[model samples]
Target chain A: MNTMEAMLASLPDQYRWAADLTSPSLRAATGALVCGMGGSGIAGDVAGDVAAGAPVFVRKGYGIPGWAERLRPLVVAVSYSGNTEETLSGVEAADRAGLAIAAVSSGGALSRLARDHGWPLVEVPGGLQPRAAFGYLTGAVMRILESAGLVGETGLVEAATVTDELLGADLDGPGRRLADDLAEGLAGRITLIVASGSAAAAAYRWKTQINENAKSPAFTTTIPETDHNEIVGWSTLGSAIRRTVGVVALRDTHEPPRVAARFEPTLGRLSEGASLVGEVWAQGEHPLARIASLCVIGDMVSLRLARNAAVDPVPVEAIEVLKRELGET
Target chain B: MNTMEAMLASLPDQYRWAADLTSPSLRAATGALVCGMGGSGIAGDVAGDVAAGAPVFVRKGYGIPGWAERLRPLVVAVSYSGNTEETLSGVEAADRAGLAIAAVSSGGALSRLARDHGWPLVEVPGGLQPRAAFGYLTGAVMRILESAGLVGETGLVEAATVTDELLGADLDGPGRRLADDLAEGLAGRITLIVASGSAAAAAYRWKTQINENAKSPAFTTTIPETDHNEIVGWSTLGSAIRRTVGVVALRDTHEPPRVAARFEPTLGRLSEGASLVGEVWAQGEHPLARIASLCVIGDMVSLRLARNAAVDPVPVEAIEVLKRELGET
Candidate 1:
C-alpha cells in the first residue's frame, strides 16, 4: 500500500492518540483561528464546518483578521513539519498582538516557541507529508479546542470503521468502481468539482489531489455561488469547454436539499456533451465519516488517474523546487 | 463603446446614486452577513475587506452558518434582479431564525417581502445584468451597514473621481496602454491570476470577466497560500502550463509588507517561461480607488480580450436556462 492508503487505514489510531494528548489549560476566547498552510490548514476548514458554538476560521496568511483582535480568538499555529514560514510568522504576530495562541506540530521552531513561551502545544508524530497526516492534525485540533471547552467527542468515533470497510472492499466495490470509471472519463481533461457545505471540503481535496497526483488541471467551485458566475462560463465557452471538461458533484446526506436541487439543473445544463458528469454520495451515517468517505473516494480516483498517466502518486518534487527558490527570496 | 465599457464608465454614477439614496433604519446587530450570489455577492466580499470593527461575511448557501445564532449577525439579502432563489430562501430562513434582516434589490419578491415585513430595502436600478451592477450593489451594502452602525464612513469617497478619470482617458493613456499590453500578451491563452489582500478581489473580478467576456479558461490563487499546493502544479505541469498560461499579479500599496514578501518568492519560483508575467499597481491613494483601480484595469483587459475573440461581452443565456430549470424543480 502507498503512504496515503496506510495513513487512511491508521486514522482510528491517530484519533485515539490525539484525544489522549495532554497540553496546558487553554484560556477562554470568543472565537478560534487556525493558522496553517496547504493540507495542514484544511483540517481547520473541516473543524469550522461543525464548530457551531464559536467562530472557527482558518487564516492562511501572516496575521489574524482585523476583527480577530476584539474577539480575542484562540489562535492555533499548525505546521506539519513545523517549518511553514506563514504559520510561523502568524504565531509571532499573534503573540505580539497579545492574542491567546497555541501550537500543533511534529517538531520545529514552533515547538521550541511553545516551550519557551509557555504556550499549550500538541506534538504530533513526525516524518509525514502534511497532506497525508490530515487525520492526526484534525484530531489534535479538536482535542486542543476541547481543552478550551470549544468542542465535543461524540460525533466521529465511527468514521474509521466505515472508512476501513470502504477501503477494504476493493474487488468490484462501489468506490473502486467509481474510481475506475472516473479514471477513464477524466483522463487528460480539465476537471470541475461542484459541492456544498461539509462536502465543499471534499471538493477542494479532490481538486488539489487531481492537480498534484495526476498533473492535470482541475478547479473547484462552491454552490450556489458558482451557479451565479461559473454557469455563465459554461454558456459562453460552449463546445471548447464541453470537449475537455469532466464535472463531478460531491453530495452529502447532511447537506440542504437546495444543494441537490441546484445540482440536477446545473448538471443538466452544463454536463451534456461534456467529457464526463458524475456524483458520489456520502457513505456512512456520521458527519465526519461521510465527509471522509467522499474524500477517500476522491483520493482513490486521483490515484487511478496517476496510475494511468504512469506517474508516481507520492512525490512532490515540485514543492521542493519551490522551497529552494523561495529560500533565496 | 461596448456594453462592458459603458458599464465600467458608469460605475462612478452607480456608486453616487447607491450612496445618496435613503432606506429604512436597520436593526442593530453584532456582525453582518451579506446574503447574495454571483456578482452581487462579490459586493459583500469588498465590504468584508474594509469592515474594521465588526466581522462581515458573504454567505452563498441556502441558510446562514450554524454559529449565526450565537453571533446574531445582520443578514442583508442582495439580488440585483430581486429574484435569486438562494437569496430568497436564505432571507426566509434568516427571518425564521429571528436574525436582523434587510434587503437590496430593484423589484421582485424580495422587495415585496421587505415591504410586507417592514425590513429595510435598498432598491437597486433595474435593466442591467447583476455582474455589471457591482459598484451600485457594493455602495448600497456599505450604506446598509452604515445605517446599522456597523461601518464607519471614513474611506472610499474618492473611488468615483479616480475611476471616472481612468474611464475617460483615451488611446495611449496609462490605463489604455496597460490594457493594450495585456491584450497582446494574453490573447488565446489561459490566464492564471495571483493576487493578495484587497487586490485579491480584483483578481477574482478579472478571472470571472475573462471567463465570460473572452470565453476562456482562467483560475486565481491567493498569495502565500498558493506557495503550498499550486506551486506543485507549477512544478509538475511546467512546460505545458507555461506554453498556455498568462500570469498576472494584482498589487496594492495597502497590502501588508508580508503580502509582498510572499509575492517576490512565489513569482521568483513560478513565472519562468510563462506566456505572460506582469503586474498592475493600484492607482490613487485611498483604499477604494486602489481596489477599484485594479479591477477597472482588469475590466479593460477582459473587454480587449472579447474584442479580439469577436464575442459580445454581455448576456449569459445559460444562467437564464438554469433559473428556468430551478423554477420548475
Candidate 2:
C-alpha cells in the first residue's frame, strides 16, 4: 500500500515525460482516431479538447464501421493491457483498411501487433492497473496529437510545468489549508462540476469519481453548452437545491472572455440555493501538463471523498463482478 | 389532437413508400456512414443493425474523424429539417474529403446542398416533427444503405412487412391485448430492457422512451454483453431486486439459437427475486419493416408506461432546460 502511494505520487512526473515524447508523433499525422473502451476512452476526450488542426474521433466497439475502412485515418488504439477486444478489433480494422496506426499499451496483444506491424508504439510503464495509469495514457495521447501536427507543442510543455508546481504546492499543505476548507463546504452535499472548453473532460472525470468513489450522485455539464440548456433546470429545484454543492473549474485560458465572465454570475445565481466552491487552475505551458494536473487533482479529491465516505478508494466490487461475469479474466 | 393521431396512424404506409424508393440507391456504395442528431440518429442505429454485408457507422457530431475520411466511405447525412448544423457540418466534412454522399431530409439546407452538389437525395415528406417522422427516417436510412450495396435488399422488404403487421394487429387494433399486459407488469417497478442483436437497438429505444416519457430512471443492457457484466451486479440488492422488472425482447430469426436458449435461463436466474416479462417479436420479411415494427412497439410501450405513471409523455421540462442552457435551440 505504501509503494502504491509512492507510485501514485510519482505519476505526475512520469506523465510529463510520456506527453513530451509523444508530442512529436502527433504533429505529423493527417488525421487521428483514438480507439479504446470504457475509462481508457477518457484520454480521447482530453485529446479532443487540445488537438490542434487534425480532427479526432473516439471509437468504442467490437468492429469498425465500414466507412472507417475508406477514410484511412491515422489511428491510436489504446488499451491499458494492450488486449481490449474492442480496441484490438479497431486496430485490426485499421490495419486491414491500410490506415496509419499507432499503439499505446503497457503490454498485450496490441503491443505484439504493433511490433509485428511496425506501427509506432508508445509503451506505458507496467505495474499500475489501467485506471490508475491515467497520467501515462493522457500524456501519451497529447504527445501523439502534438507529433501528428494536430496541436501546438508549446501549450503542452507549459501545462506540464504548471501541473508539477500545483501538485508540489499541495493546497492542503500547512499554510494553504485548502483541503479542509473545501471539505467543510462539501460535507453532506452533492457536488456539481461545471467547466468550459477543454476543462469539460476534467469536470466529467470529477463527477464520475465523486459518484464511484464517494458512492454519491454527482453531475457535470460543460459551459456554453450548459449555459444554454441546464440553467433553466436550476430554476425548478427551488428549496431542495440548497442541498447541492457547485464546483466550477476555472481555466484562465481557452474559454472566451464572454464565457469566462458568465461564470461568476452563474455561480452567484445558483449560490442562492446551493453552496458554491471555486477552484481556478491556470493552464500549464503545455496543454498535456495542464490537462493532466486537473485530472490528478480530481483523482485526489475523489480519493479523499472516498475516505470521507468510509469506502475503499480502489476496487469497485460492482464493476468487478460485471467484468468477471463477462469472462474478462 | 384527433388529426394528429390520424397523421400518426398514416406513418407506417408513408414509411413503406420511402423505403421502397430509396433502397436501390444504397445498394451500390462500398461502405456507409449515417450522420444525424438525436431522433434522426435513432434511424441510423436501426439501419446499421439491419445492414447485411457492409458495416455502417452512425456519426453524431460536428465532423467525421480523420480516419473515417481516409476510408472514402459513402455518407448519408440525415436531418429532418435538412438544416441541422451538426449534420450539415458532417456533410461538408465528407464533401471536402471527397466521399460519395447522400442526403435524407424534408427540404432544408442539406437538401439544397445535396442538389447543388448533385449528390443522391431522398426527400422525406414534410409537415411532421422530426420525432413523429421516425418511420420515414428509418426507411430512408434502410433504402440508402441498400442502394449503397452495403446490405441485402430482401431484409428491407421483410422488415417493412413485419412493421405493417405489428401496427395493424396489436398497437392500432381494438382487440390488441399486449399493451394492457405490459402495463400491468411494468407499473410501479423500475423497468430494465434487455435484448440481443438488432433488437438491442429497439431495447435502447425502449429505455430512452421510458426515461423521457415515464420520467423515471430505467436502464438497458444488451444481452451477451450483460451476460458478461451486469448479471453479477444483481447479487448485492437482495430483496430490493423484487422491485425491479425485466423486459426481454426476443426476435425469431436473427439471434443465434444458443443465445436464444440462454435468454430464459438467464432471466429466470436474474429474476428469481424480481419480475420478468418476455415479448417475442417475429421480424418482418424486410429489414426496414422489422426495425420499424419494433420501434413502434417500443414507443407505444414507453408512452403507456408514462401514462400509467401519470406523467405527460411528450414534454421533458428538464431536457428543455438543458437545451436552453446549452443554447442548442
Candidate 3:
C-alpha cells in the first residue's frame, strides 16, 4: 500500500483519538465563524452542515466578515500545521475584533498565538498531510462545539460511531471498484460533481480530492442554482465536447423534496450531453455520518486514480514551492 | 450585430435608466440579504462587494439562512423574469419569517407576490436575457439600499456614472482583442479564472460567461485559498494535461496588500505548467465600476468566443427544458 492508502486506513483511529476530547473553558455563542483554508478549512464545511442549533459560517479567505465583527460569533480557527497564513490572518482579525476564539492545530504559529493570547487550543498529532488529518480536525471542532453547548452530545457520538463502523470494514472492495469506474472515463474529460443542500459539501470534497489526489480538473455546480445557468450549457453542449466530460451526482436522502425532484431531470438532461459516471448516495442517518461516508469514498477513489495514473498522492510539492517562493517557508 | 451584441451594447443605458431611482419608504436594517439564482443572483455578488454601511449577504440557494430569519436583514429578491423558482422560494421564506423584502424583476410571479404582499418593487424592462439585465438588476439593488438608508446616494450615482462612461466609449477595442487572444488557445483546453478579494465576484462572472456564452467548461479558484490546494495541482500537472489547460488571472487594485502579494508567485507557479492566457485588471475608481468593467469585458469575450465557434449566445434551451419538465412553465 502507498502512503495515502495507509493514511486513509488510519482514519478510524484518528477519529477515535479525538472522539471524546473536550474543552471545559470554551464559551457558547450565537453562531460560529470557522477560519481556515484548503484542508483545514474543510472541517468548517463539514461542521456547518452537521452542527445543530447555531449556524456556522466558514471563512476561506483572509479575515472574518465585516458584520461578524459586531456580532462577535465564536471563532474556530483550524490549521493542521498551525501555520496556515490565511487561518492566521483570520484568527488575528477575530482577536482584533475581540471575538472569542478556539484554535485547532498540531504545533506552529497558531498554537503559539493561542498560547500568547490565552485562547483555548486543541492540538492534533503532527507529520501527516493536512488533508489526511481531516478526521482529527473535525473531531476537535465537534468537541469544541459540544463543550461550548452548541450541539447535543448524542449526535456527535453516533456520528463518530457510524464513521468508525462504515470505514473499518474492508476498505478495498467498493472504493477500488468506484475508482476503476471513474478512472476509465475520467482521462481527457473534465468531471462535474452535481449536488444540492448539505450534500453540496461532499460534492466539493469530491472535486478537491480529484484535483489534489488524482491531479485532474473537476468542477461543482449546485442544484436549483445550476438549473438557472449551468443547465443551459450542459443541455446545449456539442457531441464531441460533451463526450469529453463526465458527471458525478452526489444524492442525499435528506434533501428537501423540491431539491430532490430537480436531480433526476437535471441528471437526465446532463446525461444526454455528457457521460454519467455514476451516483453516490449519502450514507447513515446523522448528517456527519452521511458527509463522512461520501468524503471517504471520494478520498479512496482519488488515491486509486492516482495509483492508476502512476503518480504519488502523498506529496503536494507545488504548494510547497509556492509557499517557499512567497518566503512563508 | 447579434442579439447578445446589441444587449451588451445597451449596458450604459441600463445603468442610466436606474441612476436616479430610489424608494423613500424602505426601512433601514443592520445588513442586507440578496436572494436570486443564475444571472440575477450575480447582482447580489456585485452589490455585496460595492455596498457601504451595511454588509450584504448573497444567498444563491433556496430559502434564507436560519440565522438570517432571526437577524432580520433586509431581503432583496431579484429575478429578471420574476419567475425563478429558487428566488421565489427565498422570497417566500423571507415573507414567512416576517422579513422585509424589495423585489426586482420585469413582470412575473415575483411581481405579483410583491404586489399581493404590498412589498416594495422595482420593475426592470422585460424581453432580455437575465444575464443581459445585470446593469439594471444592480441598479435596482443600489437604489433599494439607498432608500433603506443602508448606503449613501453619492456612491450609487458615482458607480452608475462610472459604468456608463467606461462602457459607452466604443465597446470594440480591448474586449475584442482579449477574446481573440483567448479563443486562439481555448478550443481544446479548459480555462481557469483566478482572482482574489472582491474581484473574485468578477472571476465567477467570467467563468459563467464562458460557460453560458462560449458553451465551454471553466472553473474558478480564489487566491490565498488556491495557494493552499489548487496551486499544488497546477504545479504538479503532467505536460500533456498541463497543455490542455489555460489560466486567466483577474487582478484587482482594491485587494488587500497580502492578497495582492500572493498573485505574482501563484501565477508564476501556474504558468510553468499551464498557458497563462494573460491578466485582466479591474478598472474604475469605484467598487461597482471595477466589478462592472471586469464583467462587461468577460461578457464581450464570451459573445466573441460564441461567434468564433458559430454558436448563438441568446437561447438557453437547457434551462427552459428543465423548467418545463419540472412543470414550472
Candidate 4:
C-alpha cells in the first residue's frame, strides 16, 4: 500500500486508541474556540457538532473575529506539527485576551507555548502528514470536549472498540469492490453528495475529497434542506447536464426516522437521470466510532476514485497556487 | 421611483421605529436564530452582527440541521407573506422540536399558525414584496430574538431611531451617497463581501443582495477564518479572474481592535488586482438601525448593479424552473 493507504489501514485502530487515551477537560468554560489550519480544522468542525452548546468557533486565520475578543473564550489551538503560523497567531490572540488556552500538537511552536505557559496540551503522535493524522486530531478534540463537560459521554470507549473490530473485519473490503462500481457509475458525471443530520459534515468532507483527490467537481447539500431548494435546481438542468450527474447518499443510523422517510423518495425522484449510490455506515457502540468509520470509508473511496481517474490523490495544485498567492508561505 | 425604491425609501424610518418597539425582546434572548426565505433571510444575516452574545444561524431551507434539532432552539421564522413553503416547513419542524418559535409575517399560513398555536408573531405590513420588506423583517427578527431573552438590548433603541431619520435622508446623504461610488467600483466584478465581529452579518447581507438583486455571482466570508484557507486560494487565480474581483469591507465600531487592525493589511495583501470599497456603519442609538442601514444601502447598490448587468431585478427564472421541474408547484 502507498503511504495514504497505509495511514488509512491503521486509522481505525489509531482513532480508537486516541479516543480512549485522551481525558475530557473540565466543562467550566465560559465559552470555547478552536484554532487550527487545513485538515486540523476538520477536528474543530466535529468538535463544534458534538459541543454545540459550547459556542465553538474555528479559527483558520491569523486574526480572531471581533466578538471573540470580548467573549474571552477557552481556546484550543491545534497543529499537527505544532508550528502552523495561523494556529500560533490564534494562540497569541488568546494569550492577549487572557482567555483560558490549550494546545493539541505533536511537537512544535504550539507545543512549546503549551509547555512554557503551562496550558493543558494533548500530545498527538508525530510522523504522519497532517491529513493522515485526521483520526488522531478528531478523536483528541472529542476527548477534550467530553472531559471539559461540554458534551455528554456517549459510551465512546465501546464505540471505539466496535469501530476497531469493524475495521479489522474488512468493512472497507466492500468499499474497494464498490470503487469500480462507483467509477463505472460516475464516469463523465458530476457527483452530488446528499447527507442528513450529522452526516452533513461527512458529506461535505466527501465533496472536498472528491474535488481534491478525484480531481473532479462535486457539490454537496444536506437532506430535507436540499429536498426543498437544491433538488429544484437539479430538475431544471438540461437533459445533457442531468445525464452527467450522479447522487451519492451517505446514510448513518443516527438519522431521524423522518429524515430516512424523506431520503428514499427524494433519491428516487432525483435518480431519473443521475446514478445513485448508497453507502451505509456500520453501526458502532459509540457515536464517535460511527462518525469516524464513515469518515475513513469516505477518505478511502475518494482515494480509490482518484486512482481510477489516473490522478495523484495528494497534490492539489490549484489549492496550492491559491495558498501561495495568498502568501501563506 | 418604483415600488421597490419606495419601499427602500421607507425602510430607514421603519427600522428605527421597530428598533424602539422591540428593545425588550432583543434584550432577553441568549442567542438568536433567523429563519426566512430569500431576502427575508437577509434580516437574520444583518442581525447576526448587532446581536451580542447571540450567534445567528440563518435557515433558508425546509429543515434545520440535525444538531439544531437537539438544541430545542428559539427560532424566529420570517416569511413576508407568512406562506413560504420552506419557512412553513421549518416552523413546523421547530414547533415539533418544542423550540421557542416566533413568526414574522403579514398574513398567511405562518401568521395563522402563530396565532392558532399562540406563538409570538410580528405582523409586518403586507403589499410590499418580500424583498422590499427588508427593514420590517430585519427589525422584527431582531426584536423577537431580543424579547425572547436571546441577546442584549444595547443599541436596539438607538439604531431604530437613527434608521427612521435616515429614511428621509437623501440618497446623497453623506454615508448613503456612496451608493454610486460602490456601484462604480463593483461594475464588471465579482464582489466579495468581508466583515468581522458585528459586521459579519452585514457582510453576508451584502453578498445575498448582490446575488439576488444584482443578479450576479458574489461571495461572503468572515475574517480570521477566511484569512487562513480562502486567502491562499486568491493567489492561485489567474490575472483575468483577479482583475474581475472586487472586495467590499463592511466595518462597524464594535469590532475588536486587533480584528479591525488586520483588515487593511489583509485586504491589501489578498486583493492584488481587485478594487476595494469600504462601507462603515455608524453606531447609531440602536443596533437595529446600525444593521438595517447597511442592508438597505447594499440593496440599493445591488439593484443598481443589476440594472447595469441588464438583468431583471426580480424573478429568478433558473430557480423557478428548477422548482417547477421538481414538482414543487
List the candidate numbers ranked by DockQ, top first: 3, 1, 4, 2
- Residues B1-329, model 3: lDDT tens digits: 88888888888778777886656368777788899888999988888877733668788887888777656789999999988888899998898988999999999999999889899999999999999998889888888877877677524455555555544555565556775676766665567889986787888888778778777667788898887767655544466656666898888888888889899988887777678887878777777778887777778778877887788988877777788888885
Q: Model 3 chain B, poorest ten-residue lDDT window?
A: B154-163
DockQ of each: 0.52, 0.12, 0.53, 0.15
Candidate 1 per-residue C-alpha lDDT over A1-329 given as tens digits, one digit per residue, 9 for 90 to 100: 66655665566566566656664488765678899988788778777775755678888877677767766789998888887888898898899889988888999888999999999998889887677777788777777777776666624556666556656643234677887887788776667787876787778778777766776667787777766666655544445546566888888887767677787777665564354457888887766677778877787788778888777777876667667765722
Provide all candidates' interface root-mean-square deviations.
Answer: 2.6, 7.1, 2.6, 7.0
lDDT of 4 at B37: 65
lDDT of 3 by residue, A105-155 (tens): 999999999999999999999889899888888888877877777666524
Model 1: per-residue Cα lDDT over B169-266, one tens digit each = 44234687788688778876767888886676778888877766665656788887776776555444446446666788888887777667677767
Candidate number achieving the greatest TM-score relative to the actual structure: 3
lDDT of 4 at B283: 49
Candidate 1 stretches with Cα past 4 Å from truth are: A2-5, A19-29, A169-174, A238-243, A272-274, B19-29, B169-173, B238-244, B268-274
Report residue A178 deviation for candidate 4 (angstroms).
3.6
TM-score of each: 0.92, 0.71, 0.94, 0.71
Better of 3 and 4 by lDDT: 3
1 versus 3: better TM-score goes to: 3
TM-score of chain A of 1: 0.91
